[model samples]
Target: MLMYCEDPSSFCSLVLNITSATGNFIGNQLDLLYLGWVASLLYPAILVFIILPSLILVLLYISAFLLYIYMRRKKVYNVLNETLHRDPWASGRYLISLLWDAHGYIWHGYEVRGLENLPDEGPCLIIYYHGAIPIDIYYLVARTILTKGRLIHCVGDRFLEKVPGWKVILEAFHITPGTITSCVQTLSENNILSISPGGVREAQFSDHNYQLMWGNRTGFAKVAIESKSPVVPLFTENLREAFRTVSWPQRLWIALYEKLRFPIAPIYGGFPVKLRAHLGEPIYHREGETVEELAQRIRASLNSLIQRKQKLPGNILRALLARFYEPTKNE
Candidate 1:
């Protein structure tokens, strides 16, 4: 065999021929497979990302328009019948309640304890352990509306006011800052004031659900004392299930975005979760107690209530039983 193929040119030609044939076969196969893959993916990808999204947007717009029309008609009738006395806040609250109910009933699948502790009448300060998400506020609003048409003014951060449409929504809900003047004005109007003393730091730090952000929150108690309002300690379990907050790079990005006045927390949920809020017995302000003393007392009350609840076994049976139990009315 070596003698027969002694010419170097002949051997080189044989090797080149084999290599060219192998390359051509692989190239042809790849082209055929790639073409088939493209044909299979093209239509489905277009339908999913483009056409489907457009259809969803159109349907949402039409639904929103119809809802607005229905609400407007009801409002006009209420005004004409002199049933509502042209109160926009009342109308807004009614609409919000209706919307809330339609999506999901209040405490329908959740449980609320300590409702008996909430005052039946008069200006009071309701402070709760704020959750990672702000769903606790919605639960409080729903509860307040059902119990008494007493408006609950929330002391929110100045950052929320900077967001484009958020300022309007917050204002409509009578949510103000956790400032002294604002607290005094809100209480003087005979309206209940709700404050989460933990502010943004709590929301950021409480990555796990049900974990409180309040290590040192005394301003709420001071507000209650100065306003002569009783401090109502509130606790919400399972409220964190509504939405999970970003913990890492996403959290860092969100903080920066918030600084730029943008809502960076990406949250998506249908029909708000059935969050339950427990209102503890009121702690009245002493006649001449210092603000520090008042704050400490309020903190102690809240911390104790939360600790007691935490000791309970987090089992499905307990949750179901709680949901079925009716809350006792405040005396």
Candidate 2:
């Protein structure tokens, strides 16, 4: 029976010859079916263990290739900026152009409204309500480059200087906040200067509700007064939605990170999201304005602009649609 079973055709012939042999033949067939079922279940496990890692490696390779292309283009710009010692404003504009071109014109998402209102040439203090993420600075930089080819001296947190390669890049961009004297000098040079009064505190506490972290942003007004630069009130539409903040508990934990002088809030918005930046009418500084009064007025102007921009139906629709597209511009 065992030998006959090994050769199934012979077993079937023998089973036809004897009815009792049919039961043994049926049992053997059932055992074979059971074995095939067991093998089918285990086959997928073997393939996953042996093949998945290789597939992941291939994906990693593709990602690396894209990153290499991005880095190489950026390196060329850096070399050009260094070799030419280009005018600061021109250099900034060139960089923005390079980034925009590389990213396939992502900056077009911005529906700029007040370019006509920006001065053709002058010293100005541009105060924009900052987004929770740092992309707001990039948008401001891009706009400045587009209009005047002038670099805006951005006052960033002191901690940014501590980052390894970031320090050198920030310095190249003429970003400095180490001292009031340096700030004053930059402003005196007729270079545009931008400040986000909310700073790190706003980034940490702004939550994802589109609320401004600014309670009373007096420092920017004071800077405007000291520097004698006219205040430009800028507003960004859908900037916060570009990078949503994490949960409140996570934000609280991040608020405790001390490597930075302030809390290191984790920014959650990035690729596949659209952002828009807009410049409002410039709020000219009053000659005899006290710092407190100027600050109040600047805040009021920014809030009003925010409310107006937010109410625009087109802006709101674009903001929602931006969630699906990757940003190509500096922001």
Candidate 3:
């Protein structure tokens, strides 16, 4: 009896310890119950509030992208068709050119030299800096036709296709969008193609500072390289004064106008101002040059040309009276 009684107390203590451990394990589950309940409440709210809105935004972005592609395709097709339509009035551009020539002569006593610098034949990529209203384009086109007898197709802004009167004007001038494909075709066919890499932003923001606004626009270099064409850099003076762009509600308004492809700028004096244009020596592309390097080279060339325009001697009043008093060939 004594031998069995000695271990009975120790055995009783072990049994009590096991009971205490089992009770604490059940108590820990009760403590976690509140946290589990909170997670269940939050999971549904997060899915409905945060995840749902993000999904809707994603869908909207996709829709907008598809719409932009469709409109761009439609515009390209229409422009190609218009290009095929021949202008029966071969002298149409000639008359228009004369008008601008007279206008430039009267206004700013405009003088555009360097017609000799342009090649007498095709496949020339006429890359120029955009002035206030691209008055340079008109001056050069008219002068080339009047002087060299070559028609130049300018690469216009994407917004031109949507302009009220500009659609007709674009078709008449054989202008197309500045897409890579268009440039390639224009150059390969040995046609004179003029492009402004800076485009509308450059035109809108110019304040007689002939700085190149072509931000990272290197595609033109690729086109020129692939076409194996000589690039002709050209620029003009006092273009901003001729027809200055006006802006109201500056930033927000301009941003909205851009989205809609609508330019909303208040225009000031047009015509009868001092005008000047200069065509630079043609820059030939070396084989295997990177587009970035070529673009920088082109930018440097245009800047040099603009700096020269500043040095030329010009008198507004005398040049104006000289042109206004002269008789037209028709007269």
**In terms of TM-score, which candidate is strongest?**
1
Residue 153 displacement (Å), model 1: 0.8
Candidate 3 local lDDT, 137-255, one digit each (tens): 88778778766768888988777787678776677678888689878988798878898888877777655455678988898888889898888888875555566666555686468
Quantify all predictions' global Cα lDDT against the true fold: 0.66, 0.65, 0.71
lDDT at 264 for candidate 2? 57
Compute the lDDT of residue 58 as modeled in candidate 1: 77
Superior candidate under TM-score, 2 versus 3: 2
Candidate with better TM-score, 1 vs 3: 1
Model 2 lDDT per residue over 179-285, tens place: 55666667777877778787777676664345566776576776777778788887766666666555557645554754446655566655434455667777767
CA lDDT of 293 in candidate 3? 93
The clash tally of candidate 2 reads: 5
Segments of candidate 1 deviating more than 4 angstroms: 1-86, 104-111, 249-274, 311-331
lDDT of 3 at 13: 65
TM-score of each: 0.66, 0.65, 0.64
Clashes of each: 0, 5, 7
Q: Write the per-residue lDDT of candidate 1 for residues 294-326, one digit (tens) a residue.
A: 877777787787666543323333344445553
Clashes of 3: 7
